[model samples]
Target: MAKHYPPLPISIWRHPAHILAFGFGSGLSPKAPGTVGTLAAVPFVWLAMQYSLMPYLIILLVASLVGIYVCDKTARDLRVHDHPGIVWDEFVGYGITLIAAPDTSYALLLAFFWFRLFDIAKPWPIRVLDAKVHGGWGIMLDDIVAGMFAWVAVQLSYLLWQLF
Candidate 1:
């Protein structure tokens, strides 16, 4: 489905925040923008994993906070709230989803699939939060929760692999 994203012409790409909020242009994909944005985040997730866990956590914390502002400002600029093109939340969420798993490509792939499923399904409280939240939080909260679910799934998958 084509969301009411503003036309991403040269003018839209001119703004740094817009570019960031759009997942460095990955979010602009006409089909499955969220998926594309999450996929684009894998490299970042891997890069962040090069650091120790504490630093990675700190980095994500800062990124999440920054994402709120970027998402908010970009939405306002586009005159469309929670537009599909605004997928910084997906970047943050996907990164968060991989946190509990090993940094190997297999683990990252698991996180990616589980995160995408929970994100698309919007199970339980995810659906509830999406309905009630607004603005930047509205755009982010559901995906964060989905990331949490995916985290659990990723961790479990890791454990199961060890057990076998």
Candidate 2:
């Protein structure tokens, strides 16, 4: 079972693990840290886009894998199961959400909103996976699912727009 954790202290930021786990400081936002982290990730999408699809996908995979370690170590250090301030998952999730998405302002905006909604709402399997799973995968999978859900909505909207 996950132990209850108090809000993180300023001192926590000094550690390298915490720094990465906190979305490189975006997670430090006084409010809606996850949303902030996801938004902060938007600019980075272009960096991944510099590569072709396969390379971008590989980058996502590697980042996600690294996120598991970052999240796990940070949680263990804090003695918390999954801290709200640990928003590296949000960054990675948003990256996954925008993969293969059309590089349009509208698409990016829609993806940002959709990913935030699904991440916050935690619908269906997202909520289920969050609870049933444990450890780092547990923490990351929920956001990944949320990203997929958001990605689907964005893709469908693009397709529907083309038809109309």
Each model's Cα RMSD: 1.7, 2.6
lDDT of 2 by residue, 1-112 (tens): 3344566755556888778888889887777788888888888776786788999899889888988888888878777777877888897888888889877778779889
- Backbone clashes in candidate 1 total 0
How does residue 95 of candidate 2 score in lDDT?
80
Instruction: Give me candidate 2's TM-score against the actual structure.
Output: 0.91
lDDT score, candidate 2, position 11: 56
In the predicted model 2, the residue pairs found to clash are none
Candidate 1 C-alpha error for residue 47, in Å: 0.2
Q: Cα lDDT of all candidates, in order?
A: 0.85, 0.83
Write the residue-wise lDDT of candidate 1 on 2-116 in tens digits: 4455465445488888888989999888889999999899899899988888898998898889888888888787777788877889888888897756768898889899999
Question: Which residue pairs in candidate 1 have backbone atoms (N, alpha carbon, C) closer than 3 angstroms, thus clashing?
Answer: none
Leading candidate by TM-score = 1
Which structure among the candidates has the greatest lDDT?
Answer: 1
Per-candidate TM-score against the hidden true structure:
0.93, 0.91
